[model samples]
Target: MPRFPRLTAAATAALALGLLAAAPATSDEPLVTEARVSAHFDLAAGQTPENIALDGDGSADLTFALARQVAHVTADGATSIRATLPAVAHPATPIVTSAAVTGIARAHDGTLYVNYATGTSATGVWRLPPDGGAPEQIAALPADGLPNGLALDEARGMLYVADSVRGTVWRVPRAGGTAAVWATGAALAPLPAPPAYGFGANGIKLRRDAVWVSNTDRGTLLRIPVLQDGSAGPAETRANGLDGVDDFAFPGHGRSVLAALNSGSRVVLVRADGTVTTVLTEADGLSHPTAVAVRGRTVYVPSAALSTQRDPNLVLARLRHFISRG
Candidate 1:
């Protein structure tokens, strides 16, 4: 599971109060509507979906964090295990308790790439072939760091990995080779040790000639330009005040984004102007929502239920007033 900061008694109480005090939708037409649980996962079986990758057929591929399995869910909500990573004997991971799969990206040819944090030399990016055979490690990342979010640039044949523990973004070739540090700065660094388990860069995506990242500890969304020479330019803060922001997806053609606030147990819409609108909350069956994926008019949210420990499931919502770019 993705590491989270240990909340103090007062902080926990404040979160509860904040959730209770959240204002209801005042807009005549809400951005998200008709939210409902599409599939309920078995928490006892460690089937918590951490991140999501959508297929063209309205299906989704998810990384079952603690289960170390990649699962496929049909449009009708039926689930099947696609691939499972090998179990680690003993892990020396920091903050996070066990070894598991965190992020996943599906290539155009049906190839699946996932990040596995085993706290050993085996920790790195692994690739599952389209033919459904065994998976193999494609790139080697830091053994001590937690690789949380992954994004594939199919056109460029590159993969960007977000390391939550190390506070860095790594670049790896799609053909499989050594990983290189693409970007690192204070914006990506975790907060000092007071709260503990403060994850830095949690979620990542490549969009519009730039790489976007979410800082879970700092609660900020950042954008780094992809320079002309294939190098990273200056990092800019695109949005802030988003506590517990995890994986996000850009819906439609414009700059509007749908982000998951894991600790807040909410999914919000961050507009192009930087204003945030709380679109979905706990009442929408969000139990520690970990990621957001938009396919056509449907928005998919996978709740890890790490804190709630209730229903770890997939919630589907309709995107109102959305116009597809394609």
Candidate 2:
């Protein structure tokens, strides 16, 4: 079966321009434009923070669970050794030893919650107190056989886990007990895997009344309107054509959803109206960033050292507020 090209007449005419124009048309949608990606913020040496966790203590903590260890440092400092996820992969690792903090959530009351969607079985979800010391297991929710992404509903105290393997979105209480099947739609379906996310869900986030799921396998973003009881509303494609969207950041008081775009050395910003723009070029030396979070105006992104990872590359970039085009 071949894809019936959805090319427009303008695109068809552009194809007449030569093979170069048609070259880009083959991909259907181009998420980034040359204008949006105008700057690059190189990675900081020591305080290279991955996975930004905004704490109520007015301090920002970064999680690095790579090479079988999950540790935390400050996004505001030049690298400070604090604590590590004690589950230990081979030695003292993040949770399941090699699995890192894919997604993290914090309550208004200042409770810290973390998710372990990869690595070994001992890995799951954990919680930290307001002051931050040791993280304890909540209960053992039923995550997709191989979980990876997560989101938190602070007001209602619900945690949503994106089980890419099972194609299911699971929910559990803040205290942690039994994982309940919250919503099962495209996420829980028998989608293909790897290279193309038939069901490869990664990053998840909650805004006002909805939850956003990132389909890295297919370069699409799903926004499922959620209710107070965890029931889902209409699910729609918020943004697409991303180059492996590992994580996203909503630079507050603005209209930008800055994302950690893998496969490329930049952070892309997608507006609410579905128009995409590139905000940074060669963002913090990002290497397929896997996790991201935002606080007020600042943005934090964590890159995965896939190949030659020397030292640890954790990046914290301040997302400049976008000026309205109108």
Candidate 3:
């Protein structure tokens, strides 16, 4: 969801209030619980949950940069969407820029990594103050770009950024150092981009061990073998049901993977052995479901109509607990 933030005043910010009333933006805070998003909560109209990452202590929290909000919900759910979250614990800073938030990554300190569309000649990655500070342009993405996805290798303290246009992944050194090419998808002589369709590697997942990439245009879940020299292995296609795949995550449990088929208009799950099944149907309300993320029990999916108000952000309430069970 891209925003045309009024003027250069920067995008607006929203935070989950009430219980989060006095929560400090400091790195350490019990603001989020360890339990993934669980059942029982209501959703605000037009709030689109974008991506997921662990807070300082590993609590499942989702960043909804587009809605200019962040919501705490389950990574999987069983009942209705409302049944997933107990309540909206916190509303995040409306740190959304004019560009719709194509992707979001979380820092160990709970800071958010934001990606915006290249409107006109603008393209780059922005860092939302973990607590309360101004966002800084860390990298200026290539112009005429697709959604550049990102993942933080916590152990290595490196940020892996995927650029579909250039068909390359860059490794940004820790603590805001220069970025270098870590892995190149299209650059790989093995998995070259298709002539007709580009392999738009948009979403990235840095697990406890390796890295997983959602090849949007390729319709495959790529398992990138981590390397000591940083040269990624030839990606293995973990699943094939992805149709216009976007972003996905392991939902904290690591038994299954949830993916968004943007053009396909649905959200699907792939089990351990690459078993694919439909979880959230378009019938329930998925209009061009774009990016997705999971907390503890909740999985947030933002259905975008491409700047159309008719199809505002469609929130999939409780998700974690339910998807986990199924």
Looking at model 2, residue 73 earns an lDDT score of: 45
Candidate 2, lDDT over the whole model: 0.54
Candidates, ranked, TM-score = 1, 2, 3
lDDT of model 2 at position 104: 64
TM-scores for all candidates?
A: 0.92, 0.72, 0.65
Q: How accurate locally, in lDDT, is each candidate?
A: 0.86, 0.54, 0.53
Expressed as tens digits, the lDDT of each residue in 1-326 for candidate 1 is 34443557643332211002223335787879999999999877778889999999999999988788999999999999999998877875556656779999999899999999889988999999999999899999999898999999998899999998899999999999999999999998888756645689989998879999999888899999999878899899999999888999987666668999987799998877789989999999999999999987799999988777689999999977673331
Q: For residues 29-54, what per-residue lDDT tens digits would candidate 2 score against the true structure?
A: 43333222111222222222335566
lDDT of 3 by residue, 66-183 (tens): 4434444433432222111112123221222233444567775767665544432335566766665655657655555544567877788777776665556667764664557666
User: For each predicted model, how many residue pairs clash, with residues at least 3 apart or on different chains?
Assistant: 0, 14, 49
RMSD of 2: 12.0
In model 1, how many backbone clashes occur?
0
